[model samples]
Target: MVIGAGPVGENVVDRVRAGGLTAAIVESELIGGECSYWACMPSKALLRPAIARSDARKVAGLRESVYGPLDAMEVFAHRDKVVGHWKDGGQVDWLDSIDVRVFRGHGRLHGPRKVEVTSPEGERHVLTARHAVAVCTGTRALLPELPGLPAAHPWTSREATSSDRVPERLVVVGGGVVGVEMATAYQALGAKVTLLVRGGGLLPRMEPFLGEHVAAALTARGADVRTDTAVSAVVRDGGTGPVTVLLEGGDHVEGDEVLFATGRKPRTEDIGLETVGLAPGSWLDVDDSLRVTGSDWLYAVGDVNHRALMTHQGKYQARIAGAAIAARAQGGDSALDTGRWGAHAATADHAAVTQVVFSDPEAAAVGLTLAEAERAGYRVRAVDLDMRSVAGAGLYAQGYRGHARMVVDLDREVVLGAAFVGPGIGELLHSATVAVTGEVPIARLWHAVPAYPTLSEAWLRLLEAYRG
Candidate 1:
């Protein structure tokens, strides 16, 4: 049994059936999870075209000349197409093809191997899993305490993704991925955007150079990006349009929409976890097999587990949990070691998970930032470079002030982390992820060729700087 038809849960069910096992899936909302609907898919779908347009303007200087105006309606229609009109009929068909049972409403554990599902029409069904129940219930937004916020209606990522109307002005609170992505989305949608970031800079988890580069890019794009700023109040004065958010330090920001792109919380409050001896924060604690800490037949994955929160990471976790469940059902060793790829092996969550903020002049980092590298007790050597030397970047972007950096382990002669910030660096992130995860040695990495004049050349340059 799989709870929450999110990317992780859906992947688990598919893989379970693929391994010739019977599977049942329960979903309270959409299939394909938040990424498929709200978070990754819709957000990126909105951002990608804008980015392509931005790049076109940068290279050919043809902003108004070549592309006169974009139809947001048409654009949204295309996005809806990519999302299959926000319908899970295709997903349901695929699941049925694989022989997985589909149920609506919420699902939770009743006991060791039992799951109780509540349907939308108040129908209840109990299911007994012969192998295990993988919990992938995902998560909910975490709203901060702000005066007047409740009374004045605010849009979370959910509202932002689903809304057909683009507001005149959008004030985004929180400078993380959601905040930045939504900020770019609204800005591209013709909304005057003021991004309020509580931290000193956007994507503080990334390298400072990347953050600085992205800050400049967003500023250049007319986003009123402000870091070291916190939201204080939300006021909805009639005729004043919609929510007006008061930021810290006496500055006032009013917007037709206020998006709380703040963070998220595990959906632990209402799940049936407590019924099975779990505590208040009943996001099931799991073992190497992803099996609940003390129970071998109960496994957990996705946001509910409080692991890595990205959709990609969640899918990987699902694959691991599914494989473990399959092994257990087939009388294979169930001592699932996450590092060994059997027990919800999102090993990258701890070892190295690359994060990319897809706004213009994107920010990216894999493994650890310099600060984290040092704190983790690595004797780290760092190098920074302007990405202009890369042939592809120079040709693609004029007046580009791109930057790249590498955090190296002095003892191991290997890169501990890397960051690239520029117009097209988002695509450059995976190479770093490969280097970090593959533990490719620096000398050998130098021999590994990057296509000439390409943004990939930055990899070679980073290696050169590291040696110096």
Candidate 2:
């Protein structure tokens, strides 16, 4: 049985059925989960037009023609179409074809191996799992506790992504992926955007240069990128007027809409974790196979496990967990391969996790940063390349300002991590992911020649810089 039919849960059930096991999935909301409706799909849809226009503006002859603001309505319409107008019929049909039982309700742990589901009509049903129960309830946007925030009707990630109309003025409070991406989208769609980052830099989790490039680009696009700014309170008169965000000092910024993209908390608050001797609202600890710690039958996949919050990472975990459960059900512990990089192990969660921020001058990275690699006690060398020097990048854009950094493990002679910050660099991330995940040696990478006159040639440049 799977609780919360998000992408993670759906993947779990799909894999379980593929493993020749009967499965049931329970969800209170849509079948495809957050990625299908609110978070990834809609957010990316909103970003693509903005990014495309921005890229076009950088081209030589095309720059003059694409300078106008995006058609906000058309962009919203396209976004709506991408999300199937917030419908899940197709997703439901796919599940039906898979022969997976779907329970439309709020599913909670009744006890060991048992789930109690309450439907929207308040009808109750209990299900007992034959092998395992996977909890894939993803997270919701976390709004900080501040004065008048709730009363002011602040927008979380869901509202930010799914809103039909763009606000005239948007005050985004966070430096994370959601904050930067939305700021980029709204600014391009003809909104005055003020991005408030409590931290000193954006994309703080990645290399420092990535955030630096993104900040410069956002500022160049006329966004008010404020760093080290802390919000003390927020107020909106009559709950329908402009939101006034009070800063730590005697200062404030007003906007037609305020978005809090500070962070995310697990959605396990009311999923009956207390019944299973776990905290009611906490991230579930899991082993390499995604099974909840100290329990054989309980597996926590996706954001609920706090392994890697990205949808793709969650789906990866689901695949591993589903396979592990099947193996255990078939032939006990002997049937499972629990070693690192094994068929049932999610080792990549620790070693080769990848992320791409859809902000202007896209930031993509995999594995460790230079700081992260050094902190991990590896003997590392940081090789840097100005992406503008690459022939392909120069042809791709007029200025083509960007940077690439590859952290090499000197002892092992393998790529430890890599980050690229520039326009259209999102596609260049997978090669880095492959290098880090495969632990491909620096010598071997030198032989893996990159195609000339492409942004990918940045790899060859990085290798040459490392050789120097």
Candidate 3:
């Protein structure tokens, strides 16, 4: 039995059936999960229109104007269209075609080989699993405990994505991916956006310069990006009107709506996990093999297991878990370790890997930041360069201020990490990712050659700047 039919769960179930095994899918929410229906699907729907309209605003066909605003209704409609109107009839048919049984309700583990599901109509069935039971129950949003904040009208990612109306003024309480993306989208849709960040800078997870570019681009787009600002409390300006936010600095800002994009925590609560006689956070842990610790009959995958939170990463984790379970069921020695699979392994968790912030200008990064590298006791060489010298920059935009960095293992003569920030540098990350993952020697990486007149030429330029 597969618990949670999110993308990861669905992928696992499909894989199980393809192995000629009988599998049942249990879901209590939308089948496609956040990516297909809410998080990625709708957010991208909102952004694509702006990106296309912006492109059309350039020296291109029809050069249409008066396209003026992003119609939220249209965006929502498009999202629904992509999700097939949120009707699972199509999904249900496909699941049936795959010969997998579907159980609609909240499912919980009863024992080592037992799954108990409560149907929507109050019907209950005890399913005795003949094969392995996989838990793909994904993560849930983490809400910060700010004083008097819950009383105010606050929009989670869900409320914001499904919004049919745009607020006149918006206060986004976090500077993470969701906050910046929503802020940009709504700012384009004509909202006065004020983003408050508790961190020292935005995208603190990436390089400082990358964070600077994102903050600059957001400010360029008319968003008031405030770093080092925290919300003390949220006061309902009562009587069904706009909300007012009081910052820790004794200042106040009012907006038609407030959004909380703080972060996310795994969804391990109230699922009857304790009945398994396993401790929380430890037993539900997915090993490199994607197996639940101490139990071969049970496994957990995706964000709920806290493996990797990104939808894409969760799906990959689920795929590994699914394959492992299938192999074991077929009586194969499927005992696998997470140490191998460079870039594919859980190695990145211990050693930081490439990550890019997908804000307007975008920021790409791989491996440790300068501070982190130094702290980890690496004899390091770090250099930063203006992105314009690289051919990739000139092609990105006539007026583009980009940044690039190269972190060298000075002793090993290899590149430890690299980062690029500015328009279109997001794709340029793959080259850096390859370099870091392959542990490519700096001298050899020079010969890895980026095409002429491309942003990637920045790689070679960065190498030169390293020596200077």
Candidate 4:
């Protein structure tokens, strides 16, 4: 049984059914989950046009023709098409084809191996799992505690991604991926954007240079990027007027809409975790196989596990957990392989988590940064390259301003991480993910020659920098 029929839980059910196990999934909201409807799909749809136009303006002859603003209505229409107009009928059909039972309502742990689902109509149904119960309920946007924030009708990630009309002025309050991405999209779609970052810079989780490049680009695009700024309070009169965000220093910024993209918290509060002797609102602790710690039949995958909050990583964990459950159901411990990088182990969660921030100068990275590797006690060296130095990058864009870094573990002579900050680098992340997760030796990487005159040739430049 799976609770939360998001993409994570859907993948779990798919895998379990593939292993000849019956599955039932319960969801209180949409069937396809946050990524399918709100976070990834709609957000990227909104960004693609903006990024495409930005890239076009960088080209030699095309720059003059593409300087016009994007058609905001068309962009919103495209986004709506991408998200299937916020409907899940097709997703429901897919689940039906897979033969997985779908329960629509709030699902919670009734007891061990039992789930009690409360339907929207207030009907109660208790489901007992014969094999395992997997919880894939993802996280929700975290809004900071600020005065008048709740009453001001502040937009969370959900609202930011789903809103049809762009605001005349947008005050984004975070430096994280959601904040930066939304700011980029709205600014391009014709909004005066003020990005208020409490931190010193943006994309603080990645290498410092990545954030620096992004900040510079956003500023160049006319975004008011403020660093080391704190919001003391937010006030919106009548809940529909311009929002005034009061800063810590007695300064204030007003916007037609204020979006709080601060952070995320697990969506496990009312999921009946207390019945299982676990904290009601805490992230679930999981083993390598994604089984909840201290419980054999209970599993937690996706954002709720707090392993990696990415949708792709959650789906990866779902696959591992599903396989592990199948293996154990057939036999005992003998049938399972829980060793490092084993079929049933989510080893990449720790070593090779990858992400691509779809902001105007796209930031893509896999595995660790140089700081992360050093903190992990690995003897690592970071090799940096100006992406414009690569012949392919110069051909791709006029100025072609970007940076790439490869962190190599000196002891193992393998690539520990790679970060690329520039346009058209999102697709380049998979190669780095392969190198880090496969533990490909630096010597072996030298032989994997990159194709000439493409952005991918940045790989060769990165290798040369490492050699130097």
Candidate 5:
């Protein structure tokens, strides 16, 4: 049985059924999960037009043609289309086609291998899993506890991404992916946007230079990117009026809407973890195969396990967990393969976690950064390059300004990590992901050459910088 029928849960059930196991999946909300309606799909849909226009304006011939604000209605319509009109009928059909039983309700654990589902109509159903139960419930937006903040009814990622009408003026709190992307989208759609970052800079998890580059670009595009700022209080008339965000320094920012895109916490609080000897709100601890520690029949995949929060990473965990569950079910303990990169192991979570932040001058990275590599006790050489030096980048954009960095593990002679910040680096990340995951040697990488007059040539330049 798989609880929380998001993409991760759906993938888990798919793998389990492929391994010849009967499975049932349960979801309380939309079957396709957050990514479908409120996250990856809708968010990307809203950002793509602005991104495309930016890309076009960078090109010489197209620069003269592209100008002005994006059609807000058109963008919202496209986002609606991308989210399938916020409906799950198609997802349901696909799940049904796969022969997985679909249960619509809130699913909670009723002790070992037992699930109790409460339907919307006040009906209840109990399910027993003979083999294993996988928890694939993801996370929710975490709002900071400020006095009267809840009363102000601020937008989280959900409201920010799925909102049909752009706020006239948006004050976005937090400088992470959600905050930056929503700020960028609304700014492009004609909203006066002010991004408040409590930390030193934006995209703080990536290389510092990446954050600097993104911050500069956002500023160039007319966003008030304020760093080292925090909100201390909030005021709204009746939870639906203009929001006044009081800053830490006694000043306040008033806007038509205020968004707290702070971060996310696991959605495990109400999922019945306490019934099975686990804390209700705590993150679930799991082994490499995604099995809950000390429990053979219970598994936790996706954000609920706190392994990795990204959608793609969660789906990868689901595949591994599903395979492990099937093996343990069919052939018992002896059939399990728990070695690193084994059939059932989730090795990439530890070594090659990849992230792409879809903001202007997009930020992308795979594996560990220079600090991470050094802290891991690896002898490392970090190489940096101005991405503008790449011939392809110049051709792609006349005055292309960006940076790329590669962290090499000297002892292993392999790339430990890579980061790219530029107009079109989102597509460049997977190559780094492959290099890190495959542990591709630097010598071998020299021969797998990137074609000229493309952003990919940045890889060749990094290699050259490393050799120098």
Candidate 6:
């Protein structure tokens, strides 16, 4: 049995069924999950047009033709099309094609390898997994507690991404991926955006230079990016008026709508964790095979485990967990391949997690940053370069501005991490992920040449600097 029929859950069911086992998936909401509707799919749908127009605006001859604002209606229509008009019929059909049983309800653990699903009409179904049960319930936005904030009708990630119309003025309350990406999308779609970051900068989890370049680009695009700002209170008259946000310094700001993208908390609460010797609302601990600690028949994948709070990472873990379940079911625990890079181990989550932020002058990173590598007790050297120095980058965009950094392990002379901040950098991330995951040495990287007059040429420049 698998709970939470998101991409991770669906993948888990797919893999286990491929192993010749019967499987069932339970979901209370849409079958395709958050990424299919509200989060990744719709959010990226809204941002892509803005990014394309911005890319065109950078080229000399094309800049004049692409100066107008994005067509909000057409953009929203395209977004609706991409998200299947907020329906899950196609997803359900796909699951049916795969021969996986779908249970429509809220599913929770009842004990070892037992699942209880309650339908919307108060009907309950009990399911017993022959081998293992997997939890793929992801997370919801974490909203901070401020006076009257709950009554103010603030938009979390769900509403921010799925809204039908863009607000005239939007006040964003965090500087993380969701906040910045939504701000960029709405501002390009014609919202006057004011970004509030309680921290000193944006994307604090990434290398400092990546955030610095992103902040500069956001400002250049006319977003009011404020750092070290906080909201203490909120007021919305009758829950249908402009939101009035009271700041800590006794100042106030009002906007047509306010978005709180502070953070995320796992959706473990009310999932019956207490029935299984585990605390309610706590992140599940798991091994490399994704088996929940202290239990062989239980596994947790995705954000519910708190391993890596990303859609792609969760899918990767699901594949590993599903394979492990099949192996253990057929040939006992001893047959499981739990070694690093093994068929059933999620080794890349620790040293090769890759991410790409779709903000203008996109930010992409893979593996450990220089600071993380040093803290992990590795001798490392970081080589930094102005991305504009690459001839291909200049040709890609007139007056291009960007930065790239590669952290090399001095002891082994291999790339530990690489961060790229510039236009067209998203696609360059996989090369770094491959290098970090494969442990490819710096000398071997030299033989794998990057095409000339492309953003990929930045790799050659970094290698030359490392040699120097």
CA-lDDT, candidates in order: 0.80, 0.93, 0.77, 0.93, 0.91, 0.91
For each candidate in turn, give its C-alpha RMSD to the true structure in angstroms. Answer: 2.1, 0.8, 3.0, 0.8, 0.9, 0.9
TM-score of model number 5: 0.99
Global CA lDDT of candidate 1, please? 0.80
lDDT of the structure predicted as candidate 6: 0.91
lDDT by residue (1-468, candidate 4, tens digit) is 999999999999999999989999999998999999989999999999999998998899999999888999999999999999989999999999999999999999999999999999999999999999999999998888889999999999999999989899999999999999999999999999999999689999999999999999999989999999999999988898899999998999999999999999999999999998999999999999999999989999999988888999999999999998888889865898888789999999989999999998999999998989999999989999899888888787888899999999999899989999999989899999999989999889999988888888888888887888
lDDT of 5 by residue, 108-183 (tens): 9999999999999989988999999999889999999899998988999999998989888999999888988898
Q: How many angstroms is residue 274 displaced in model 3 relative to the true structure, after the best TM-score fit?
A: 1.1
How many clashes would you count in candidate 3? Answer: 2
In terms of TM-score, which candidate is stronger, 1 or 6? 6
Tens digits of per-residue lDDT, candidate 3, 87-206, equal 677777888889889999998888887889998898999898887888887766678888767778589888887787778999998887888788877887778999999968877776
- Tens-place lDDT digits, model 6, residues 1-468: 999999999999999988878889999999989889989999999999999999999898899999998999999999999999989999999889889999999999998789999999999988999999998888989999899998998999999888988898899999999998998899999998989999689988889888888889889889989989989999998898788889999988889999999999888897778889999888899999999999989899998888778899999999999889888889988898788889999998898888899999899999998889999999999999899889999898998889999999999998999999999999999998999999999999999899898999899999999898
Q: Indicate the residue-level lDDT of 263 in model 5.
A: 86
Per-residue error at 255 for model 1, in Å? 1.0
* Error in Å for residue 468 of model 1: 2.7
Better of 3 and 4 by TM-score: 4
Candidate 5 clashes between residue pairs 3 or more apart in a chain or in different chains: none
